[model samples]
Target: MGGRVLGYGTYHVLTHLTSTELYSHCELVRNKLVPLK
Candidate 1:
């Protein structure tokens, strides 16, 4: 039970990190593809 909980926590943290990284990457690409004022 503890192991499962730990696994879930780790997965959630990693997912959060990945989501932020992906969003940053998308922003960079969008800046290159689209002009922003």
Candidate 2:
């Protein structure tokens, strides 16, 4: 996916950070994860 897609996914994940998976996602973003899809 393109950066725009990754960005949107990140935003969606962050908005739902209450979920366990989303919490992990937040960590991934916080740690500067790349190649997210």
Candidate 3:
């Protein structure tokens, strides 16, 4: 996948950050992530 797709996926996940369904996975995934923008 390209950055475009990656960006979209990130946006989708961020938008759903409060979702109970993905909370655990999101936390694990975002634990070490830092935004440059």
Candidate 4:
């Protein structure tokens, strides 16, 4: 997929990062993540 699509997917994934248990996974992408801006 393209960068834009990948970014969207990452944003979607971030949305599910509310459960502290998943913070680690969120951190992995948080730095390189680009929201739907």
Candidate No. with top lDDT:
1
1-37, model 2: which lDDT tens digit per residue? 5999999999988777668777788888977855543
**Candidate 1, run of 10 with poorest lDDT:** 28-37
Q: Report lDDT (CA) for all predictions.
A: 0.96, 0.80, 0.78, 0.75
Comparing 3 and 4 on TM-score, the stronger one: 3
Instruction: Find the candidate with the highest TM-score and give its number.
Output: 1
lDDT of 4 at 33: 75
| lDDT string, candidate 3, 1-37, tens digits | 6999999999898778757657887777787574532
Candidate 1 TM-score versus the reference = 0.80
lDDT of 1 by residue, 6-25 (tens): 99999999999999999999
TM-score on alpha carbons, each prediction? 0.80, 0.43, 0.43, 0.41
> Residue by residue across 1-37, what tens digits does model 4's lDDT show?
6999999999887777655547776876786676733
Error of 1 at 4 (Å): 0.6
Model 1 Cα RMSD, Å?
2.3
TM-score of predicted model 2?
0.43
Clashing pairs in 3: none
RMSD of model 4 against the true structure: 14.8
Candidate that beats the other on lDDT, 2 or 4, i.e. the better one = 2
Q: Give the CA lDDT, 0 to 100, for residue 3 in model 1.
A: 100
User: How well does candidate 4 match the true structure in TM-score terms?
Assistant: 0.41
